[model samples]
Target: MSLLFVLAFLVGPPAVLLTVIGPPIRGWPTTDQLRAWLQQPLTEETLTAGLAIGAWLIWLLVAYTVAVRIIIRLRATTAWLRRMPLPTPLQATASGMAGAAVFGITTNTVTTTPPEPPQPVATGTAAFHDETAPKDHRDPAAREDGVTVAGGWLPWEVAEQVTAAAALVWLRRRRDYQPHPTHPDDTDLTPLPPTVTAVQAALADAPTTPPSDRTAALLEALPIGGLGLTGPGALSVGRGLLVTAVLAGQRHSPTTLIVTRATLVLLLGPAGETLGRRLPLTIVDTVDEAAQPLQPAGPAAEEFSPGQRPDEPSSGPNHQTIVLLNEHDGDEEQLTRLAATGTATAALVVVLGERPDGPNWHANSTGHLHDPHHPNMPTPRLCVLDQTAATDLLTVIASPDPAPPGLASERPPLPNAGPPKLSLPRQVARREPPHLSTPPRQRLHLRVLGDPQLLIDGEPLTIRRSAGLQVLVYLAIHPNGADTAQLTDAIWPGLPRHSLTGRLYTALSELRSTIRTASDLPVVNHSDDRYRLNPAHIDVDLWQLHATIHQAAANLTHTTTAWQAVLNAYTADLATTRTWPWLDPHREATRRRIIDLCAALAEKEPDPHRALQLLQDGIRIDPYNAELHRQVSWASTELQPWDRLTNNHG
Candidate 1:
């Protein structure tokens, strides 16, 4: 509202007065009248009115600024309110109505004069009708056709109504359209296999014949209404279609749908039929039951029963089955214990709500007992099911199965094979390379033990462990050793003076062992108690990487060569997880070097495609880099012209 007031005072009033009163006042006394009016403007009444208008305009402008600041603060404080969920249509409608209301109110308050009708000129009249004609004016009908033939103030009310109505209609249409839902079934599922033939063959070999009317009876017994198919033949087709539809909806491969559907039908149909014929009515009822009672507990229960041993065969009815159900709570020890007791013949069911890393049943290859003491103990046949499927699967397992003629009279060999092997081709041995005969090169072998200690080459250098390594690395970095006392005090500030020498000896022993193992070079030598890493014997990749980076930095304008040099020097982060007091500064310096190289390449490379590729590779190493993104954006603009047209339009 204050903004409107400021606009009205500064612009609206001047425009209105000039159009409405200026022409009339100018004509009041012709030349003589204008001169008189200008002379009269020094009157007290005119000055008072002018001063009052200026003061009101100034106050309105200040008020507008204050109001804008208050609005910004209010938005900041209640920002979360914008994220609160609201019905889309209601939100759209409210927005539209608010905009219309604001436009209507503002337009009503602002007064605008109607433009005067254009005077038509007589083609050849002495009356000077041509002199009064509006410049670039056209007939009213032509203007009404939507062409702006003349310039003049447009009434605010008409413009407001037009804009508000258009906006309201657009909002209403947007609210009317429904957005499509993202169905989980629509996701790609093309990675499964089909086994229809296997299922049919299993069914055909069953010993007992199914009743002729069995399929019809089962269809009638189905809980769900209106299955279009009945009987064995119809049931097969219906099952196939149902499986296909489910798989298709899930976007799975057609082959996978066939295999999974066939498997399901074999399990639920022929397998169920064979079980039904053999089991007594009472046993069938028990098998179909939902939950089993937890086994009774006693002092003797802690020990395995004679037949309860995983390998022991039960002497009860051949069909009698034991179903073991275990839940994992993510304790590795508990999982190990459960796995140790399971046998191959025992049906082991594991119910897990979350993935247990490294120690879960899925991670076990043999599903064998986890203990060395029970190495020969048979492990259970493992079945993993989510919570919802556990009850049904458990019931099926408890059910008695009639020994179908082909119930594998003999158990098949286990499928738990050992590690996969590569097939190697026959080959002849070759002579050794020339470099193999040379004695091992003398180099520093740095060995880090437990915490802070470094062995330089093979000899135990007499220097503080922390200080010696720092001095060695610094020297390895600088190509020159530091003063002994200077290095000692740098690493061990405020140390007790007496024990410093003893501590330095221990540190030097560890450093010597480390350096000897790390390289075969006599890299470290003491000259007047000052230690240094022999630069020639050390094979540090850091030096090479840095040298290459320096070379690249020196030749930024010749980017092709510079980029190649940087690429050759690139390596995975140095001792990425290891931390040292001195390593951080070096790491940071290397990072800055790489960044500078990238900047130089970005500036010198004329081909945006090449630049974009370089930036992308850099991003892979440093994902959070902002400079890479900036370079990518610039390169994209350069590439945009190539994609301007499509062949289809032509």
Candidate 2:
């Protein structure tokens, strides 16, 4: 209503006055003649008559209505664009995908070292399938088409929608998509063997509704179309088309790309080393090795062909194989035979040189493809990946599978490890006061022990990006500071430093700007390429908790007071509800220490009731701890007799 009033005031008066002022200004009547006409009686012929006044009133209403509708239409379009799920180029890139990996979300094991003897810690596994269920955007069960195709060649709106829909579908399938289980603590970083589920996840989401018939045609032609490339950028162009086909393979019919290890590296750069293990790729050592049909091995082999004999031809209606070859290694006879087999089999085979009988596209050094055979046809833009783009995309594709439920099945034996010894430096412990000292209140307070939040004085400050908040949490854990590479590994694991330098820098810059804007103090300090929070300006609760624990360890005389302070400092588990891959170690370690502290305090308590309360606190954290349960039972027994005697006396 307020907006309408403002619009009316700006436009309504000017529009209404046009009727009274328009005709005379256009020379229908002179200024003197117009003034004289107003003095005339209410006659039908006069301009000042009642009929003329009524017509002008109707004109004002019509003009206002049109203006209001136009304004509304414009606003609606703006909002729609704002809400559109547009997948940026970054989203398809390696760093972008790394950020999307299911790190600690569902059920995953993380190794954390506590006090002296190492014990396997179980961070309670969440329900595996529940979190990965199909979101509201699209139904996962509606996978008639095998894999969604990457629609990078399509228009902006079309491409992003395709990407988002594909991601949702992949997530739905990922719940049941388990590759062979490998130990989480394995030292080897080599990519594992491929599985059917792995291939499906690597492929794009099948479109629920395509934007246009032309897009549909383009997508359809990608899997079966025998594409050949020639000229300066043939390898690059062919690589793009191959990646697109792999991403777009149908769920009912999957596509396997066969290429030599050398060619794969040339096509995708350094990322090729990891891509073969994640995507639907069968990488061989030589071009000769690529000529053979794919044989399923281990569990994947059984999943691929259950009843069929291994010696028989495994080709079925459900499989689509695309073999990528180099021109240098191919002969005329081999190329013709390969091309003929592809046509008969309803499969695709892409080459880096001109084929004898099919359409061969020419590529320029700038990574653009031109169809010389049919100049009139639209030259669909191929999905070209440079080194950085390849790394980012591979990282996204290589996102670790959601760990299965009931992880950490082999629990390490927990010996009666007495009270935890503080791992603080001797000099630092001596420098600390006997009692927990209160520092002057700082303007910025970063709390990460519970639900992570940053506040300026008392009011909560909002950080726009999740990465920005993550930086604060990571820095809070490492008070001394961390360099860029270390931060990237922690935040976006498996992404190369070169690919995500800008992303990391942007997060740091934005966080610094936000903090300075709120508190007018530069809380984040960067020098020698290391970033750290300025403790003088910003106060971290995690740091304070450690200090109190250290004070308790150093001064046994003030242990009772210090223990209480330690309890007060630890409000909850670190970054509760967050599932960063790097957070599990810190979160579990802190939780164990707190439980130990509770037990230590209870053992010393003289009053049975006080000891019972302390034991209850420990049980609240570790409900599965048998020792804590035993102590609680003993405390209850001690109190039972006293309560019965009092009742009888009353």
Candidate 3:
């Protein structure tokens, strides 16, 4: 359409000007004059010449028309013929012929025009329009005829070029403006692992609103949703606020809690206050207040009256001493001093920041805390805190009121004297389960592991640091472990075959060294040109999760306890850093398993409550799953109150 418009606009005027002015300007002899001149010559020769010219013109017209038809047919057939494999020679010939024909047709179409019929005129009078007279404005037919006659012989080359250019422009514009299909609300756009998607979905469906409105909507409606906001400070604050808000709203508390870092508190406090007022919520700034009570001061006398002391010495330690250390600052001295004081009835050590070096304290300690050599040994009460954590130790301390018998009071007074004697055996006397023997003193051991960009296992691992972690995760997922070639292909499918082995070796070596350093466990074993994680030494969540899932699957027909087992199995993304192409199938398989397990639980559970929970969980994990929606509808129907059910179904 555009091409035609451009050609008409540019070429039409030039052709008209040339046709109207050429004869008068050049004073060329008219066709009549030429004919008269020829007639005066030898009659037979002139007549033969005229007939030959006319015949050639007729032949040109016939050939041009035939070429145009052939070109049009070829254009229409090209799409259908493309599916068939043509011989090289034939293809080339066909292409050349089509091109030539198209060119010829275009050239002829632009150049050819019928000659005008002769008009009668008074003798010796100029055939010019009287401009001063009123024009025959109402006669459009006459006007069009006059315009066509005025146009001179249009050049074939120019007209063809203009037409081609316009067509090309039109095609480009059409392509640019092509409309993409609208995405359905049910489509999942998450590029991450299914586990991440599941977690996001679960959070979305929970009664509490998400931290951000945009994120909440995305989580509820879209397949995947998240914020790229980095930094421990922001995450801690955001998470705390979200959790608090959800909890508070569920409890229908008038008070609102804003848990955040000091810097954020400064920035967002006023905004929070304003929001609270508008929403009729109370906002409490918990950043600075959280750390105040956790900090240790000099020991002082017990504040409680003498009679308040537990009867019979409680047959155990009077109070549990928790040694809290900021690992990021390498400040273990404070923790050690607190542990040595012997004042704590039972010590609860909290390590903030990275894991400490080995021989870890638990390994070397002579007191009760010791490593049992089991992969799943009771991870100590050690709470590792990052600088950004919004956890108020005081709040955790205060949360469980009516403190356990002999446990320290929430407001225990600091001791008055210098640090107490550090007699190891004496400390054992005060420990609970009096028969418990003092084990070997272990160094303060903490394995700083997991993805740093994301908090896993209470510590963050940088992307560079997470590569080895990811490798361990991959091996853990593979029940039999992967061979060199398999591992190489999984990790680096795009690499050249020759380089795969080298890259695999490098990754394996680095991974082993990292795991050894982080866990102080001999996790990797090399034998028969393949590497595998030592199941006995490594405590892998993935292994436990898979086992639980399998166990649950076996008992599907019996009971709905399998639902809880399946939920417990899912903890975090399969692997954080490594993007192994081969793992996609495994990841997808696990996702389907989760979906199936949840669906089965929803269907089998006799209690509508359990069924509803299962259905909701399944929906959160697989929002796009048609089965999930069906299950939710069924569960909701079964669980609805009698009155609401009657109204709804009716």
lDDT of 1 by residue, 1-650 (tens): 97687666567655654554342222234787457669896777556556656755675676688679789888855743642233345445656766776666668756665344334333221121122112212222111111110111111121122222222322332222111111111111121111211111111212222212211111111111011111223322222222222222222221111112222323345353343232221111211120122122333234334545332322222211122112222245543333333222222212222212212222132111122234453432111222222222212223233334743233311112221121111211222224647765544333321222234445544433334455555554444466656454434432334445655666666666755555545656778767765544554445566666656655645667776777766655543433332343344434444654565455445565666676676666555555455556666775676445433356
Off by over 4 Å in 1: 1-472, 485-501, 513-520, 554-564, 642-650
**Tens-place lDDT digits, model 2, residues 565-589:** 8778988889975645466556655
Runs of candidate 2 exceeding 4 Å displacement: 1-225, 241-253, 260-262, 265-280, 283-319, 365-367, 387-411, 417-443, 449-452, 462-474, 482-531, 544-650
Cand. 3 Cα-lDDT: 0.37
What ranking of all candidate models by TM-score puts the best one first?
2, 3, 1
Candidate 2 has an lDDT of 0.55
TM-score of 3: 0.30
Shift in Å, residue 65, candidate 3: 66
Model 1 earns a TM-score of 0.27
Misplaced by over 4 Å in model 3 are: 1-467, 518-520, 554-562, 576-580, 638-650
lDDT of 3 at 263: 28
The C-alpha lDDT values of all candidates are 0.36, 0.55, 0.37
Indicate which candidate wins on lDDT. 2
At residue 196, what lDDT does model 1 achieve?
A: 15
TM-score of each: 0.27, 0.44, 0.30
**Candidate 2 deviation (Cα RMSD):** 23.0
Instruction: Quote the lDDT for 523 in model 2.
Output: 74
